[model samples]
Target chain A: MTPAVLIEKLQKRYGTVEAVKDVSFQIEPGEIFGLLGPNGAGKTTTLRCLCTLTEPDSGRIEVSGISVTEQPRLARQRLGYVAQEIALDKVLTGRELLQLQAALYHLPRAVISDRIESVLSLLGLQDYADKKTGTYSGGLKKRLDLAAGLLHQPDVLVLDEPTVGLDIESRLAVWDFLRRLREQGTTVLLTSHYLEEVDVLADRVAIIDQGVVIACGKPSELKDRVGGDRITLRIREFAPLEEAEKAKSLLQTIPTVQEVIINSSQGNSLNLVVSPQSDALLTVQKVLQEAGLPTFGIAQSRPSLDDVYLAATGRTLLDAEIAAAGTRDEKAERKKSMR
Target chain B: MSSTMTSTKASLNGKVAVAQTPSSANPVGDFFQETIALTRRLFIQLQRRPSTLIAGIIQPLMWLILFGALFQNAPQGLFGDNVNYGQFLGAGVIVFTAFGGALNAGLPVMFDREFGFLNRLLVAPLSSRYSIVAASAIFITAMSLIQTAAIVAMSAFLGAGLPDALGLGLVALIVLLLVVGVTALSLGLAFSLPGHIELIAVIFVTNLPLLFASTALVPLAFMPIWLQWVATLNPLSYAIEPIRYIYLHDNWSLNSIVMQAPWGQVTLGTALLILLSFAAAVLLSIQPRLRRSLA
Candidate 1:
């Protein structure tokens, strides 16, 4: 079977900034694919190029085997896109908005009402169908947007950051809905900054950083590939930088300890990667005590998706996000080139 | 195109993965479906809000009553023989109100762009993006005519009197033509401009100046020679002079002189022809811009 979505050598530049540089990925039919990245990592740009909203500077994107740039209308027919920001007309009621979406996708007049009813029920929007969307909570608004996207019953559903700023319950509800979609054989592709969101929903994940896909695989497989047991320790709730650095150097000398870094953002905690040591947590606590340092907190766990990110990028995902948010130039943001 | 999309769907009614490889894809049918639905959305917006439509109707009536009173005591024969200020101001108010309404055709589109609602439309599988442009033109033209009807009714009640049925029809046609041109230009701006603020600035700067320079307010004889040239060149004046001719004259004909411009005399027929050419020219000139943005 043809891949539901394929993007190769994708690159988009707004002036000197290469928003999507050499990014490529493909999703098999019925698979949930996630493009995981930080805020300025170009996930949205890649989705835009695939959806034909913005032309890529250089890339080949296919939806159900249709070239997005060559036969955009046909490609669009095969893809349903829900952008990161939900764009509902406040004055339009939920039902009316769906009707408009139905017409836009060129649904036959005869089948439109049936399709609308099915989607409304699927999203549990029956009770709010007649109510104007301005009164909807964030959850209801997102559900309505999703229903509109699915009305055409596209082969693939592409979402950009499906659960940003949503309440936990709403986020889970969206995730459950996506899982159900995959069960029904609809291919799914989404971009998300939330690590757990991708880990939970995507069958296969791609880690995008600075417009490049640094890693892609099943979540567990990627984590195992970067194999290590993890330990998080802190000298105090807010350890001094000098103490954290000293602990980092001392931990580095241990045979069981593979690597250590000071996580300054998290109250100067120390994150360590140790080769499968059963007493890794106890070893760290003993070393701290030996150095006249008090262990405020310590824990051991298996590697997480964040460890895969850390192994490749030398920084945690949260740290990358903080750095991106701080260093985002307002002028450059202005020139980010919206469609 | 078929070479690119090879999804072999047995049915196209419900599943749109390939969007009707239905053996008979009608582009015209798809265009009409989307355009009508989009136009319906605008009408629904008007029905729910109603405030903008209310203000639009009330504002023109105020212009008629207040402006008519402002010139009520003018000397006789100042505008024309046996013509009252109320009678002369009726056409100006109608034409100017429609012009203002037409100029605002882009405001909603601009807001959509700013708020990302347009992105939804952009990513959809539209048969032709011109449907978006067509919808705005239809909605604005209909709005201009509605406002025109309200003004004509109020002017008649104010003792300005009504024209014959044919005259009224002609008034609607002139307004429709002018609105079409201005609406096209405004929609072009909506797509080309970066955001809503810039589009609003363009509307603000052009709104009153064009009204003042046109024959909407005064006859060509009342202006200086340079102003007469400006008024004759103004498209709004062409729409106004014809409708004004229909109102003031009982035996109106196509060849009847509507205004004496600085260049030469403009008959009712010449005024309409000029309006026609203006509308056609604007529609053609803005095509490239619309195609760039919508394509």
Candidate 2:
């Protein structure tokens, strides 16, 4: 079967700035494919190109089988986009907004009402349907936005930063809603900076950084590919250099421990890379106790997507986001998103 | 909490909407449906937050009442007719109000663009993105009509007698032509301008100068030779002069002289043709800009 979405060597630039460069991916049907990256990492730009809101500088983007660039109207029929910022007309009631959306999509008159009703209930927005969107809380607005996007029953629902400013409860609700969407067999493509959000909700993810895809795979597979479990042990809070080195040496002797480094920035904590699924935390505690070094804290876990990002990009996602934050031009970014 | 609130009924029910086969497509019907639906959205907005429309109608009444009082006792035939100052100012107010309304037609679209609502419309598979333009034009025209009726009634009550039925129809046509033309230009700017601030700045600078340069407040004979040339060149004069003639003449025709310019007499037929050409020129000039943005 043809992929639900196929983006090949996608490139887009705004004046002197290259927003999406050499990015490509294919999403299969009925799977939640996530584009994971920090802000300004080309995720929104790639989605804009895919949604036919912006013309790509170069490359191919197809929705199912239709070329989005050449047949945007047809592609648009199959793609429902919910933008990051809620775009509700505050003067319009939610139901009225959905009716307008249905009409815009040219859904048949017979089914528009049913579709609106079903989506409102499905997103748990039935109670708020008659209220003007201006009165809704942030979470309700997002729910209503989701309802509008799903009203026409698109083949792929594309969301940008679905839960960027939503509270934890609303975020979890969105996550659950996405899972149910997958259960009902709709292809979902979303871009998010929240690592756990992607790991918890996405079936397959592509981590994009600085206009390029650094890693792409199942979350667990990407984590495993980056190698080994991590164990962070502090012999004592703010341990001296000699004690940290001693703890690192002691931990390094374990057969399951692959590597150990003293993290000087975090009070000389020892970071260990152990073979996957090993009980290295227990072993490290015993080793430090035997050496008369007090164990203030110790923990071990499987490598996370952050580790995969670190292995691929030499910096964590958080660090990249902070770096991007300092340089983000809100005005230019808004202009690029519109028109 | 949300997961337990409902099952996935949305997908189950969406089959009905999706079963709409591509083979059953109707492009013309789609265009009308989208246009009417989009137009309905603007009206709905007006109904809910009526401050704009309320102010739109009320401001023209203020102009009709206050401006009438401002020059209540000008010399007889000062505005170049057996008509009083209020009679001539009636047409001016009608055309000027519609012109003002139409010139600001792009502000809402600019807001939609800034708020990302335009992207919502753009991303949808409409019959054509021109529906966006069509919707704004229809909404603004309807709004201008309401204002025109209010001004016409106010002028008639103030002793500026109503025109014949055909003459009133001509008045509407004139107002519509001007509104449509100015609306096209405004929407063109909406798409080309970067943001609402820039668009508002352009509207602010364009509004009053065009009004003063036209015969809205004074006849061409009252101006210096330089200003007379400028007023004849202004399109608002083309819209205003014919309506003013229809209001004053009991027997009017397409060839009846409406205004005698420094160069030549502008007949009713020529003025209507000029307004038509102005509308057509604006529609054509804005096409590329609309295509680049909406396409």
Candidate 3:
């Protein structure tokens, strides 16, 4: 079967800023594909190009074998995009909004009502169908947005940060709904910064940073490829920089320790990557003790998705997110998204 | 609910094979369906929050009543033969009201852009994005007609006198022509402008100046020669003069002289032809902008 979505060398630029640079990925049919990235990482831009909302500066984007750039309408017919912002008309009620969406997608007149009803119930939005959307809470609005995106049942559903600004329960509800969609054989592609959300729901993940796809694979496979266990240790509640550096150097000398970095943002805690060994934690404790350092807190865990990102980008996702957030021009972004 | 849900889900799943293909067989049918649905949404919004319509009606009535009263005691023959200032103001008010309404046609579209509601429409498999333009034109024209009716009725009640049925139909046609062009220009601005604030600023700067430059408030003869030239060149004047002629003359034809402009005498037919050309020129000029933005 043709891939559900194919994006090759996708490059998009907003003026001088290259929003997407050399991004490529292919998602199989019926797979839940996640584009995991921090803010300003060009995830939204890639989705926009695929949805034919914004033309890419250079690239090929296809939906189910139809080229989006060459035949946008046909590609659009095969894809349903739920943008990061819920774009419902507040004056329209939930049912009325769905009706409008149905007309937009050109759902058969005979089945429009049935399709609307299915999506409303699928997202548990029946009771609120007749209520104006302005009165809906954040969760209800999101559910209604999901309902709209699913009305025509396109071959693939593309979502951008589907759970942002949602409550935990709503987020979990969305996750469950996406899982059900995949079970029903609808291809799902979503972009998210929430690591666990992608790790838990996505069958395959592409880690995007600074407009580039640095890593892509199943969550477990990517984690295992990083090839180490993570050890986080705090010498004190707020270890001094000098003490943290001393601990980092001492930990680096250990035979099993592959790398050590002092995380200054976390009160100068020491993060270590150690080669897999049953006695890795014991060895770290003993080493600290020998150096007359107190271990206020310590934890050992298998490599997480964040570790995969770190291995690829030389920085934690959180650090990249903070650096991205500081440099983002919100006004320019809003202007770009407006059209 | 659960049973309905289950049946719907089962049916949807059963038809998944067919659903993968495109659903639209008749492009024309799909176009009309989407356009009407979009048009219906605007009407529904107008129905729910009637404040805009309410204010739209009230503002024109105030212009008629207050402006009529302000110039109520003017000398006879100041405007024209056997005409009260109220009679003179009726055509101006009708033309201005419709012009103002059409000028504001972009606000909804601009708001949609700002709120990202337009993105939803853009992402869909619309038969043609021109339907978005059509929906706004239909909605704005409908609104302008309703306001025109209210103003005409109030003007007749205020003793300006109603024109014949044919004359009323002509008035509607003139308003429709003007609205179509202005709405096109406004929608073009909605797409080109960065945001609602900028669109609103353009509307603010252009609104009253266009009204003042036209012959909406006074006759061409009452103005200075340079002002006469300006008023005659204004498209709103073309729309106003024809309606004013039908109101004043009981036996008016398309060839009846409506105004004496500095350059030449313009008959009712010439005025309408001018209005038609103005509307066509504006609509034509904005096509490239609309196509670029919508594309």
> Which candidate has the highest TM-score of all?
3
Model 1 residue B120 lDDT score: 91
C-alpha RMSD over true interface residues, model 2: 1.8
**Where does model 1 exceed 4 Å of error?**
A329-338, B1-24
**What is the per-residue lDDT of model 1 for residues A286-329, given as tens digits with 9 covering 90 to 100?**
88789898888888999998899999999999999999998777
For model 2, how big is the CA root-mean-square deviation? 4.9
Best by DockQ: 3
Q: Candidate 1, clashing residue pairs?
A: none
Q: How accurate is candidate 3 locally (lDDT)?
A: 0.90
- Please report how far candidate 1 places residue B102 from its true position, in Å: 0.9
CA lDDT, every model vs. true structure: 0.88, 0.89, 0.90
DockQ for all models, in order?
0.52, 0.55, 0.57
Q: Say which docking band candidate 1 falls in.
A: medium
lDDT of 2 by residue, A193-301 (tens): 9999999999999999999998899999999788899888887889999888777777789999988867665788877788887777788778878888898888888
lDDT rank, highest first?
Answer: 3, 2, 1
Q: For residues B1-295, could you state the per-residue lDDT of candidate 1 as single tens digits?
A: 2333235432222344333442235778889999999999999999999999999999999999999999999999888999889999999999899888988999899888777788899988888989988999999998989999999999999998999999999999999989998998898888778777888899999999999999877888889989989888889999989899999998999999988888788999988888888889989998898776688
Best-to-worst TM-score order: 3, 1, 2
> Lowest-lDDT window of 10 residues in candidate 3 chain B?
B1-10
